[model samples]
Structures are given as C-alpha cells and as structure tokens.
Target: MGCVSRRTQCAPRDTRFPRSQLLQELARYTWPGNVRELRNIVERLLLLTGDAIDAATVRQVLPGRRPSTSGEAGSGTLANRVATFERDVVLQELAAHGHRVTETARALGLERSHLYKKCQQLGIDLKTERTQP
Candidate 1:
C-alpha cells in the first residue's frame, strides 16, 4: 500500500532551540508517511521558519493533533520511535507500487529478495492487503 503523489507544506523548527526542545514540539509533528515524507516536512520547516519557531506554529500547519502513543502525553519513547519508522516505510512502499508488491519493489529500487527481507524486518504483510487494480 502506497499513496497517490501529492504536494503539501509543513512548518519549520527553531535552530536556537535545543534538540530536546524540538522533541517537545511533538504536538507540532505530523505523522508523515515515510522517512522521505518526514524529511521533506523538516526541510520545509527549516527553510520557512526563522530561529525562534515553536510548537504553536507547527500545529497551525500540521493536520490533526499529534497522537500520543508517547504514553506520557509528549514523552517519545524508543519503541514509539521504531514504530514510527516502520509505519513510514510501509506507507512509502504502499504509495510507490500503487499497492502492488512487484511494482513497489521496483519503485523502491529493491530486488524481490531484498524486498521480502525488508517486509520481514518491518513486519509488513503484503498478503493481507488487496492489490492495486
């Protein structure tokens, strides 16, 4: 399962703020589909916002409030971080192949063997999903 390509904008982070501070901006983050998706968001934010950007600015642009799988209402944990990454990868692949495994592997520049390996590592089950028409 993949996405139809679309363009959207996201907010910037404050450089004067510490990394920990940005982490506090959890309320500001949108769960973008993939690493590329998230990177694009961060890049847009870095380019558009100045040194003092904060959470309020982020909330304005990001769709839906950031969900708190964080357990502590903003405390991002190691498990949560891993899950986010896995979700993104699955979404990215789903988008690329029009939701077809053979197509998705090619789109990702991966061989069938490697793709299967990745699916195993990422815990994605292609069989459960309906293929693209």
Candidate 2:
C-alpha cells in the first residue's frame, strides 16, 4: 500500500533543498495531525515548489502554528526526543539522496529493505517522498 509499489518510473534526481534550515523550521511546527499530515505537507511542497523549499515557503504554507520552544514542558522527554531525532535523521538522509531507496540505503550503510522498514517505522512514505524531483 506504499507509494513505492505504485510508481512505474523512477523519481527525478534534481531536487535541491536547504536541508538544515528547512529541517529546523519543520521541527518547530507542532503537527496536530502528526505523521500523516506531515507526509501530506511534504508531498504538496515537493509537488508545488520549483527548485527548493525554504523556511519562508514552509511558513507561508503552514501559518498560525507556533515554533516549538526548547524550554517547553515535556520537551525533554527521552522517548519523544529520541523519536524526533530519529525522524529528522532519516528525513535528512532521504532528502540528501533525492529519496532514492537504493542510494539512501547505500549512504546509510543499510540494506534497502532495512531502510524501507526504518522509513515506515519513522512514518516516512517513500513513494510520495521519491516523487519530489
């Protein structure tokens, strides 16, 4: 049921992003719908943006949500912090490789299947992600 199984051709390889800044901006948003909403937003951004998706674009697309503060209550919970870090790492790597599973796996020193499972666990939709370019 994932995006990978449905696409006929490979995704384009020219996508570019201001990786760290964008990731920081995204981390600041408190996603009300959690992973699904995040995935949808990522898909939309990839589809709509011309060359890169910046903090300004993200701010324009998702207004009204406040950026998270490090001092906020419960922000230090170990489980939450770990999960957030894991998601960020996976997403950054995926973006770095243009969401190509094989390339990403090689970069991460993981098997393609293991990377896919990891992405699923991290709530990333590889299919939608791979279509970015």
- Model 1 segments more than 4 A misplaced: 1-80, 131-133
What is the Cα root-mean-square deviation between model 1 and the actual structure?
Answer: 13.2
Taking every candidate in turn, the Cα RMSD to the unseen true structure, in Å, is 13.2, 14.8
Q: Considering every candidate listed, which one attains the maximal TM-score? A: 2
Error of 1 at 39 (Å): 10
- TM-score for each predicted model, relative to the true structure: 0.38, 0.43
lDDT for each residue of candidate 1 in 1-133, tens digit (9 for 90 to 100): 0211122222222244344444556424656576666555455445434443455434433445544433465457778666764555555556544677777666455787887787877676767544433
lDDT of 1: 0.52
Q: List where candidate 2 sits over 4 angstroms from the true fold.
A: 1-76
Model 2: per-residue lDDT, tens digit, 34-130?
5666666666556545445677656645646523434573467798766765666577667867877887787566899999898888788888887
After TM-score superposition, what is the CA distance of residue 96 in candidate 1 from its true location, in Å? Answer: 4.2
Against the correct fold, how does model 2 do in TM-score? 0.43
The C-alpha local distance difference test score for the whole of candidate 2 amounts to 0.64
